[model samples]
Target chain A: MTTGFGLNNLPYGVFSTPGTAPRVGVRFGDQVLDLAAALNDPVFASPSLNPFMAQGRARWTEVRARIPAALENGPLHPLTGVHLHMPFEVADYVDFYASEEHATNLGRMFRPDSAPLLPNWKHLPVGYHGRAGTVVPSGTGIVRPSGQRKPPNQRTPDHGPSRRLDVEVEVGFVVGSPSPLGQPIPTSAFADHVFGVCLVNDWSARDIQAWEYVPLGPFLGKSFATSISPWIVPLDALTEARVPTPPQDPAPLPYLTDAEPWGLDLSLTLSLNGHALSHPPYASMYWSPAQMLAHMTVNGASVRTGDLYASGTVSGPDASQRGSFIELTWGGENPLKLHDGSTRTFLEDGDEVTITATAPGTNGEAISFGEVKGRILPIQ
Target chain B: MTTGFGLNNLPYGVFSTPGTAPRVGVRFGDQVLDLAAALNDPVFASPSLNPFMAQGRARWTEVRARIPAALENGPLHPLTGVHLHMPFEVADYVDFYASEEHATNLGRMFRPDSAPLLPNWKHLPVGYHGRAGTVVPSGTGIVRPSGQRKPPNQRTPDHGPSRRLDVEVEVGFVVGSPSPLGQPIPTSAFADHVFGVCLVNDWSARDIQAWEYVPLGPFLGKSFATSISPWIVPLDALTEARVPTPPQDPAPLPYLTDAEPWGLDLSLTLSLNGHALSHPPYASMYWSPAQMLAHMTVNGASVRTGDLYASGTVSGPDASQRGSFIELTWGGENPLKLHDGSTRTFLEDGDEVTITATAPGTNGEAISFGEVKGRILPIQ
Candidate 1:
């Protein structure tokens, strides 16, 4: 009876015990094996995984393979006693609108008169740069952001706390090895450069976004806070989870076309308070993570070791499988009824949202990808 | 007579002589003064200004006041043999469309039927995040970015080198002091948090931008390479250059309203090859830097020590004072004749652009903001 932490899955994280500085640790059945003390490697002594991740693919493979034997003889601490931090120092964060369902849902609500999907949506993956400084670790309290929000009927905008605060369930890819300034990382080089995968909750203020996202993408609406799961599930751990993505129409350019399927067969669940609201299947995603990376760098934009890019809002075709409240509730026109007989159009104060995921492990076992949890607090 | 690098305006940078690692230095009259050797402080021994900048305003003030005496006794190296690196590691790079003239010009050309300025333009400082990893130091060659670009007449998009490469002459503000998460930095705290200003040339690919920038803001269109001058002119040195900005038609929000006017009166010159083109006046900008900083953080987004935010293309009322080539050429409808009697709609291969600025110093002397220069190279 493996609790999803068998030898097949060893996610990396930064943890600290009482009076001890934060350092690298590997998760094993309810316990964290300190990598620095177990392997006696100084690379794991740093707070961030950047130093070790920068050692490239070969080093990551060696360390991942070595962790199992080291766990047999090393001292371990229970997960409850350790405080986990941001696994890596984020370099640059780019969010891609790769979910066909989510993009179509948003386009229908935002632009009712026009076509559901934009002209360029099918041809290329649309992505934009996001605030890297505001990316916090999971369990960090989300402060309700205050900004300018104007409804359609309102003549002028009002400045106050955002009324429609929501969460976007996403899968974030982190870069380990960096590419040169003018070099484009091809789709074939995705696994070579991408270190691992983690869950992300891209908190958004819908009202602020609608009013301001015309010429510019998103600013204050999304920049306030973004939370990520503490543990990083290495790409090497998910070999059994590889699946084919939903077929793309009008095949992408040669630069973005991947010869092999790069989709992960992970299942994601979103919970509000303690009730499970939706399960957005990652297999239903339109674009693969490899294609997103290729499209991002095809223009010769370099990526750093800690660079993070997220698959924007994982949503399925069904209404119950929507990833964001905006899509699930149909842009606040329909309210979702909670398990406690309460209704929600969007998140309110003290609303806790947690997103968790799991994928197929070796020998028909399951591997957990940890969880990203956050509680909303009223404006300070 | 001082050549802009006077006693009153000693800007900070990082430079390295042959066989020596890069370290902190100050520009003083065509020579680089080593701060680590002069002050005998380890903070000045860092390769980037982030360490010293993180020490906050009081330390920065003390160091600025002590530089004159240190210059009198310290050994100086002529600037010719020194190679200047990126002064600081950019945390999050943001570009704000604060220029009324520039925004209106783009709006008029892009959306011909609608109102020039968006309804929300006057209410807030519209900005978006840019790739920090690709922000290169001045003199770095910019490779022509190739991406998916669909011209208006074409049925489908074509993937190739961008035909409409351009440059945006702007001023960049570097943040020295970081604000805590969820704590909004008021307009009055701008000078306390912002360390200095420098010249920035935000390279752009106009053709790719036109197709992809529908729902989302600019991405690869502007992410290839952003060039910044090596030297950072401290905010304290620009005291004499303060002026009143143009009046706002509608009063701004209380958070954006500054008690003291923070408008800078710097004169900027843009050159192509060796011909002087336009002179963009920073004083003509609609939004002040303080307001931009205040607006950016009002939503509880935290700022880091090395965050950089730029005033978008600083175009004045007249056509001759336009900052970006898109506006100067009216979106390629008009061509600008150079000194060689050659007309250009957009930047061609091997075209070099240099942007320089100057502000009033003490005793009627001029202080330089240095120059950000870059040459375009054909795609590899």
Candidate 2:
């Protein structure tokens, strides 16, 4: 389990037979391997999830419910690289802020003038419902968004494609048991409501957002192209990795505090241009994962599985420790001194932001959220 | 306009004649009239919007592009009473919290020890994309939600109906344009994105939220039932009421601050259990309307007319000015002492919550949001 070799990591996705057709299957090693073929022989596939069956609509979901312990020793371990698939899909996706450290840093950045700590902030987990249609699997090419961009000290307004692009590194969690509208789940039952975790890369445009956010918050700075890692690491596998507790002060409003201590000590890294300078561990956040999840449902907004919540630019204010350019350089005023004598206030065209994270004992083969590599394809 | 005739105050809905089916329109004065019946007339309608047949769609969007001065003697004056319906059929609804002040207050209530804002929160406006299906017109019944409510100091949770039921007094801004994905609107173009304003009551369940929000945010506290007033006050009518701009502390991120001063001073009130009480005006905000809209579209999120952006509970410290029970009583630990000698920690069944706002003018008829009221039904 420590090695993350548990069968619970069988990340399944809905796909098509190559042509605009909708199909479903599990992703293994380096291929959209067929789950149906491997199950041709009952004896070879009966142990865990069968091929044609694994590719079946409800297989991943049904298999996701069983404790990770049951599927750990299943016979399918030998069929690691086989091809299989079927038809299953998600109807909706609701992302929750499940990490405490991520939420803590986020709140501090936006609520600097206030207590930065909210009454409900500690008492409840929070999240926003995102567009599922754009919830593409990993490796999808992000389209360069064309929107209004304003520069500092400009008297006459200017418009153009988004030049100030940014990225958010996040671990995506999926729901297994559907939460009934109005039915509240407790902290102990968070696992029951969750199915697995994935990686998400929420792409953003910086320059366009500066002028508009006043009385109301953002309207377009976010909803654009969002990327997610392919694999779905189940909740059962993560239960063992849950940490001691959160460090929120003033205590919570009673409702937000949980019984069992929980936090994941996953190591995360973000590299720009290359894998050299940006990769950092995920442990620096002030809050915990359980706390973020708790805040999301605290509002009683019904949540569904397959939801992708991006921990928005997880960063601590320090060199070699900042998550994105926004924090590393404080919105470009303080340019990041780069290796080759070039200062980076923001990403250049050829820069690719790559994010990776892994639990200890997993060797260096980190469970990564592929990459959101887009050359600032020159504006048309 | 020195009054609070906000873009988020358009209160429109879809209703019908006792003898007919449901259609769309707004409740003006004493008349229950038809916009289609009015906009089609040469004196009332704009020629640019003729492309819409006035049935399926074509809200005030086209005409929304025209400046307010162009319509001084327009047809809106005589549509009183005529039996109004929801202004236009809403194709989509998006809500945002552009007022960083309110968002900041919430952050403080939760995390007392550290920063509560996210790094990306400054680069882009933070928001929770709301559910479109529940975007109902006024006069809708609010069903009391049932779920687990954990109290402070409890080791085990209690499963039952929600006890800490509350209402969020807010303003709803409606969009008038349909922005394509990845296409952002500049600050100057923010008005083109807005069509009007209305009042909204976001219902919340504090109990279920506390226990479940850990790994994710709210699922049951909200999304139960959100109420909106039924009459959209076009953006044209409220511009004259704009007052001095909002004051910002810690200065907003460059992308958020503006040199131009802007905001409305609309007189607003909350009638508890059908009785009126004084609430803070929309003027107490830290950010302005244009700033909020600018932040939203900056990230490339699509903006469609009829979208609703509800400013989080518009509250002040005084109980007479609290926007929600959460703040009025500070999470039930401190209950509000009401005028009727009744103390309110949360809304009770049969208790009606109405949020009304209007921009005062020389004529004194004041452009108002009318009434957004709902009686809590026992959760079955």
Candidate 3:
């Protein structure tokens, strides 16, 4: 169990003791090593990880390497005694539809009459900017979002709490380094810029999305509250998890192509009220993270430190590997049976959803990506 | 001419002299009154207007009232020698299709066989989030964005500079005060939350937009650069411009309705290379700014101090009042004759697009929203 948080998987996060202010810390098994106290540095004193995240890749690597040695002789605090917060301030949040299986499933379910995949889906990675202010840390209770929803039978929209709420199990990439405007970062340069990865539960209102998503993309449908894991597993720790992406039939453009494989073989598990629901394989994504980053910046949009972009619902080829409740329950037509003898179509008030993942470490052990858990609360 | 920047329009901005640090300033006739020096306070000393904007409506009103009296004896700097910067840090950038003409024209042009408006357009203010980090201030040169674009004849998308580049003349409302995440702000509270307004040039890549905007909305196509005016004209100054919004045909939901008129009667002019192209009437917008704000936050998205939401292309009923080149030239089918004897369907490399607007003042004078201008530079 201690090997799950081995030396190779020293993830950074912000934590605070009962009476102390928030400070940077690194997880070591069930304890947290206080990096600020260990180094006696003011750089890690900030409540958020933004100040340290802005130091770029060189500093991030240096600090990560130094953390293991510091923990051997430095102060340690029990994880139970400290409260973990949102690791870093999200500069901009972008959600990308990268999973071919998930996109195809959604298209087939939503638009049964038309072709499952859109014309441009094979050519480019489809993505949209999401609300950054509402991105909450793991364990934050998500309030049932109330908004305009148009049922299939109704001609007009009605104002009420969302009936079809869903969660997308995603792997979020945080940008540690900044790129200048009017410059495009190539697919090969992804490792030089991206900081780390974390699990994200992109809470969505399917009813609002169905009604409002027309000329524009998702807005209020997904902006209410997006929960992200507290621990950010650095890219350096996932060296063994790198796998090859699925082959493209038409082949991508030169800008979106990379000679090396960039996919990660992380196994993710989604649970509802302590019962395991489905397993979403991260390696099965059609579009690689590097390709997404390359396509995002190809048009000269600058990258800022703490900028977060998530791989849209990670689902594999099989039905058991579906990442979202919408897919598992087939848009509420099918209800999933849990271990507790309860059936769920969508998350109900007071029901808790937890997503956990693990990847193979260099030493043939499992490296966990802590948990991104959230309980849904009724409309206040 | 001087009445345009008279006592009625004291737009706030960030400016700096040759050797001084950036500070908040207000534009008077041909000079800038240093607000920090005028008030002798540290709150106005920040580089951006975010600090001042976060002070809320009461403080905003107090500062506006004292500016004129303090300017008579306060420190002044010549506008020629001062460098103006982004007035406020953009928290999030949302573009809304509030103009019926713009939406209908786009609908007809893009989907010739379909209805002029989408089914949900009448019931809701259609909007999507744009890249916030790439939002630049006025006078910033917009680099011709290069990306994957598919021509009508091409089977695959070709990676290159955008062939069809255009500008959307829009009015941006800046949120000064913020409401709770789960609570909806009513249209009646618009004055209490919105600090001011500015002009925005939503630079667009029509070809890229057409290709990528299907399942999801516009991404890289409209993300490269969005230029906003340096000065932010306070809403208090535009009291006389408040007019009744155009009649909503189907009638809005109760949450979207406003007891008082919230539309502004501002006249906007779009000029290319000094040749006037169109005059989009802001008062003709089908959905008011207040309604847009209400719809945006109704789904529980929290408003930040510097959040910017723009009224999408303010095209009126007639072709002469179009807001974008796409509408004026009818998607490159017809070219416009310029003063230099040049025919242009879309923006050229050296083309300079300037958007200026003036709203009715309380005492019959004109209140100007200082121009937002940008020159197009070829892809670097």
In candidate 3, which residue pairs get closer than 3 Å at backbone N, Cα or C atoms, i.e. clash?
none
Question: Residue-wise lDDT of candidate 2 within A250-271, one digit each (tens)?
Answer: 5654445665765565656676
Local accuracy of candidate 2 as per-residue lDDT tens digits, B327-349: 66666778767778988888888
What lDDT tens digits, residue by residue, belong to model 3 across residues A51-126?
Answer: 8888888888889888878998879998889999999989889999999999999999989999999999999899
All models, DockQ values? 0.89, 0.14, 0.86
When only chain A is evaluated, what TM-score does every model earn?
0.99, 0.73, 0.98
Best lDDT among the predictions, by candidate number: 1
Tens digits of per-residue lDDT for model 3 on B1-380?
Answer: 35588888899999999899999999988889999988999989999999888888899999999988988997988889899999999988899999999999999999999999999998989999998999999999899999989988998889999999999999999998877877788888998889999999999999999999988899998999999999999989989999999889889999999768999999999999887899999999999999999999898788998999999999999999999999999999999988888899999998999999999986788988889999999888
- In terms of lDDT, which candidate is stronger, 1 or 2? 1
Candidate 3 residue runs with Cα over 4 Å from true position: A1-3
TM-score of chain A of 2: 0.73
lDDT of 2: 0.54
Using lDDT as the yardstick, the better of models 2 and 3 is 3
Q: Against the unseen true structure, what C-alpha lDDT does each candidate score?
A: 0.93, 0.54, 0.92
RMSD list, candidates in order: 1.0, 10.8, 1.0
True C-alpha contacts between chains kept, each model in order: 0.87, 0.25, 0.80
Candidate 1: C-alpha lDDT: 0.93
Better of 1 and 2 by DockQ: 1
